[model samples]
Target: MAHDTGSSLTRIFAPAKPPAGAKAGTVGEAADAKPPVVVSLSASAPAAPAPAGAPAAKSFAEVTTDARAALDANLARMKESGRTLGMGANQGSQADIDAAFQGMDRRSLHAIASNSGGLFSKDEQAFAQTVMSQQLVEATGMDDPAGFQRDPARGFLAGVRFLDTVSAEEKASDNWRLNRAVAQTNYESSMTRDHPGEKAENVDSGDPVVNFLAQTIRSKEGTWTSVHDGSYVDDLSRITLFKDGTDASGLQKARQGAGTATRDAAARIDITL
Candidate 1:
């Protein structure tokens, strides 16, 4: 008789099939007869977003791919314009070009995208009022040290600084008391400590002093009187108001009459006797 394959020996030559509820194969039998496994894996990892204010980081391969595409478009346009062009019809290896762009830096990319593409002609110093550094240079017409030269972004920043400086100067010089009621009282009390000297100098500047002095006179902080038949004025008024004048008995009495207060200067009188 012919020898049977394992399947024929086990299944066909053996007893009839077992009931569906019964166990089929032993654990070891199933383990040894396991099928080959087929695993499927994706080609690349998922992307991660960069955080705010952070520049996005990219691999050399990714960057090179973008740079090559952009340079290709540029070459095409130059050829169409018939101004002369180069670069092969085939796309560049993104790896090499991306390496170059990454090495160049952010500003270089900006320059290439901007100036090479004839961008910013309308956006910058295209007019007189432009705050471009070149415009500032033209307006100020300064020369020599290149620092005085204009650039759009820097000129704008400098002009803002200039305006801030001017505003500070005006605040110092004008002394425009923004809170006048509070400032006025503080100033008045300080100035009237003395008058007609350095203390007065602190208060009266043109109209302020004149107005202050007039105010002092009305407030009687400044006073005028007749003493020893002399006219005496005191802001730090006179030290003494009355002095003994000789009467018939030769007794001295303070009179409502003029006293010796005027000893520092001339005396005044009106005689009705």
Candidate 2:
């Protein structure tokens, strides 16, 4: 009984044999069966490697993000250096600012420099313009495109040139006082006409004074005007010539004082006669 236990279990569990005369590799009716095909459920293969020496192209979103990050760092550095963010009256070299804006795309630079959101400072705008102007010249061999006709840097540069020309002319003229008065009157009248309500003290108003000066300088009148509305060039003189100050030298009051002095001299000569 003890010895028959293993034999009985084996007999019950063992598979049945094939019938007689069956093929060597087949069992019973499985003679025509085929091997199963294998399939894999693994993940897809990785993307092919990029070609050698090819630059990885960035998506628009990535390009914008990188541009903004660089802009933030640039602004932070400018702020740490004690530069104001929105005033155009501040005077300083733009070399550092231009360096900061280098490598930025033209679209982002133009958008930021446009100051449509009023976030960029005047210096930053000017710096961006300088970079853009350089880029335009390099690309086209000319920097006078109509697209940048309203560029602030161009406006400011024009104003500086007008001032230099006037100063040089007035220096050699005997009627320098009258000539200056006329020149100043022309600028004031043109600016007042173009930017009606904009005050020179408000440099935050997108440098309207400088823009007006540029517009007038480039106009058919070319900074010459027959209209005198009693508006003084005091603010323009300070911002353009002195860079920053409340110097009243550009005021029309000087013209009035000159007239009074001339009349006084006439009266003194008449009394002597």
TM-score per prediction, in order, is: 0.17, 0.26
Best by lDDT: 2
- Reference-based lDDT, residue 129, model 1: 10
How big is the positional error of residue 273 in model 1, measured in Å on the Cα after superposition? 99
Model 2 misplaced stretches (Cα beyond 4 Å):
1-56, 82-92, 103-127, 138-273
Give the 10-residue window scoring lowest on summed lDDT in candidate 1.
Answer: 124-133
Candidate 2 lDDT score relative to the true structure: 0.35
**lDDT string, candidate 2, 159-238, tens digits:** 22232232222222222222233234333443455456855322211222333332433332331222121121213343
Clashes of each: 14, 0
